[model samples]
Target: MKINVMTDILEANDRIAAVNRQLFDSHKNLVLNLMSSPGAGKTMLLEKTAQALRGKLRLGVIVGDVETARDKERLEKYDLPVVQLNTGSACHLDANMIASALPHVDLTNIDVLVIENVGNLVCPAEFRVGEDFKIMILSVTEGDEKPLKYPLMFRESSLLLINKIDLLKYTNFNLDEAKANARKVNPNIEIVDISCVTGEGISDWAAWLSGCYKRKFGTNSLA
Candidate 1:
């Protein structure tokens, strides 16, 4: 009989993700698993987030890429505790990869642990990596039909950041339509229009993050 190996792998990954979740909960760290397609501004968002939260949050970043520490290098300027995870042939960051990196990061003092998953809309959304929130970045340059084309990513994410709004004037993308389509897939998803380059909506993003961090950790200051 034919077997679904993918199901078995996902189940195993989820178990590990549960364990990782407990570990993060113990420290009260708000772990956000960020996913997007290539050139969706994930790195720039991280840089801008770090800048916006400067004295308010203590951050740690784990960058997952198919190869190279390129994204990690880009984030180094922020001075956050950054770890680079090269997934080799793997296209997504599974729970085991996160488990492997946990020890390398200083979680005790971290208020938030951000996992910038490898740039893909499919597999990353399927694998659970012990995150409190799954955030997806959709740039207007990708066009507005993305929510329908990539329904799973839209459906699974807790927050959707409609990034690259700075390019709206140049593209045929409809902002309201994209937001409405995303809501169709996931009614509960919280979304924001942002441009990491122009520093727009970053303060709101940071404030949301800080509020979530405070709620999760139950503290106002970085411990």
Candidate 2:
């Protein structure tokens, strides 16, 4: 006989995640789990999002990393309530981590909560943190084969942000192929091309976020 440790861990996490989902729903919060590989521009995109939706939406953030508050520090200047979770050796942020951090953030004060999961294409996709959507970023410099290489990440995500598109000329990343591959894995996944550095597509991303918030809150206006 053998113990299925991984199965047990996931089952435990799912139970916590369900509880978290109820709390978020009660607060009318639109939660998003943002995942990406290291250097894929997750922080930059969040920074841009903060700037874009400043007056329109009240945002909250949970920054997760192996051992740093650097990302948390970066978003604090935006005046958003940010909680930093240093996961130590954990490669992914499990539901228990989010449930523990919830007390640090006032869910009622935020229109949306974005959890920046530890920068990994693999483990992050395997865990559910009670998010309304799982959004992943793949930078052009990382190449187009990422969707195929990390099929589960694509399959699990609701949206695929093709980041660093301004640097496309410098890299051989094929946008068409990347979208095709992502669609192959997740047919309904929304794809958006963006550049945090150039400010391209930030409005579109913000609009999408606002739409989700409005839908969750049952409001007709973002204001």
Candidate 3:
């Protein structure tokens, strides 16, 4: 009975996600769902990405959190279209939550829409909020064994950003082992090491994001 109920819930969410995907396709907008554990620099990455792609792309963000509007406030500094979805007690943001927020976002003028899911490595991976791709972040401080313990996020994500590399000297995290473990779970996952504080590898991330946006829109304006 429990399994059936869970399946039904996911089916319902997928239905809404399909509707959201159609809306995004109509406007030729690429939506990215970003997920990570708490304090994994999700907002910091979003801030940097928004600033880097400021004039080149019509970028927008939907910030999801269990409480607080702090992430939304940080993103607003970019001066682009931003919406904060407070999920109250929900651990993760589902397609229904995204559908509710779509009414507030002007999809026509937006080229890329990034939904920053709640700061969680687990539950968020189970829900699809109608995104073209899923991007997951894992900080070095979280340890290299995370991929094996929490494989679903790694398996679901198309891109993985291993953040906080600058702090490697202070910790015992092994980059190769982390990559290997993630690859074991998701052989096709593209992983990049980045540090939001030191500005390391931010350019590659920004370029890749721009490329994705262009691929969906099919234009050379970003280049």
**Clash counts for all predictions:** 0, 0, 0
What TM value does model 2 have? Answer: 0.95
Off by over 4 Å in 1: 1-9
Candidate 3 lDDT trough over 10 residues, lowest sum: 1-10
What pairs collide in candidate 2? none
Per-residue accuracy of model 2 over 12-83 as CA lDDT, tens digit each: 888999999999999888899999999999888988998998878878899999997999999998888999
Per-residue lDDT over 1-223 for candidate 1, one digit per residue giving the tens place of the 0 to 100 score: 9886556747889999999999999987899999999889999999998888788888889999999998888888889889999999999999999999999998887778899999998989999999999999999999999999999999999899999999999999999999999999999999988999898999889888988887876777574
Off by over 4 Å in 2: 1-9, 220-223
Q: Which is the better candidate, 2 or 3, if ranked by TM-score?
A: 2
Per-candidate TM equals: 0.95, 0.95, 0.94
Predicted candidate 3 versus true structure: per-residue lDDT over 78-164, tens digit per residue: 887899999999989999999999999998878889999999889999998899999999999999999999999999999999999
Q: lDDT (0-100) at residue 112 of candidate 2?
A: 85
